[model samples]
Target: MVEYPHPVDIKVHQKSRFLDIAFDDGSHFSLPCEYLRVYSPSAETRGHSPATAKLERGKEMVSITQIEPVGQYAIKIHFDDGHNSGLYDWRYLYNLGKHHDELWQAYLDKLKAVGYQRKDPELAPPDVDV
Candidate 1:
């Protein structure tokens, strides 16, 4: 069985809309609020299955308003857009951090394909990997 990574620290920089997560494995990631919001694990985004997952749009200016911890396994992030149902676990966060570049590019590509213009360029910077 695979073991999930544990986070050592989680800091939310509301001003910059950055969520910095430091894992016990010594991996640190600076995740933009937009990225996290778009990829939220909530049913609202993921739906009932992988095939039913929906692409989020027009969230370039979204910011994390609050982060509520859920037990010892995950956190429920509250967005300024009033989306507060997603639960982000340690493993998911680590994976998101590890694949930040590819995931971000994919998000951008999808946005372009769907003609969804992003308002904030800071959402997906060229040098986002950690």
Candidate 2:
């Protein structure tokens, strides 16, 4: 069985759609919801084979709508887009959290290569001056 260093604390910053996870081993990470959604372990995201995996887009602002415990090893996360099939094992989650920076940067690069923007270009920026 894979062993995970106990999490010293887990803080979900809903406004930022980021989870700050700190392990007792003195390691910590901030995982964005969009990254989690796109990297989901669900077959729908990763597919049966890597070549068959669908490239996800326009999810830079996605959020976790719910998090359900799955036994002692995993958590099933429900995304705002209705995807809830991924059962995130503790080890997987820990790995993702640990490598969030590299993974997220890679994802951004992929999005740029595909000429995809995270948010709609046609939409005007929200008016901040009032």
Candidate 2 TM-score to native = 0.81
Candidate 1 residues lying further than 4 Å off, grouped into runs, are 122-130
lDDT of 2 by residue, 1-130 (tens): 6569766566656666776667767888777777789999999998999898878897766777888878866789888888899788777888998887898888888888998877732322122111
Report how far residue 79 has shifted in candidate 2, in Å: 1.1
What is the C-alpha local distance difference test score of each model? 0.87, 0.77
**What does candidate 1's lDDT look like per residue over 39-75, in tens digits?**
9989989889989989999888788888988899999
State every prediction's TM-score relative to the real structure.
0.89, 0.81
User: Where does candidate 2 stray beyond 4 Å?
Assistant: 6-8, 120-130
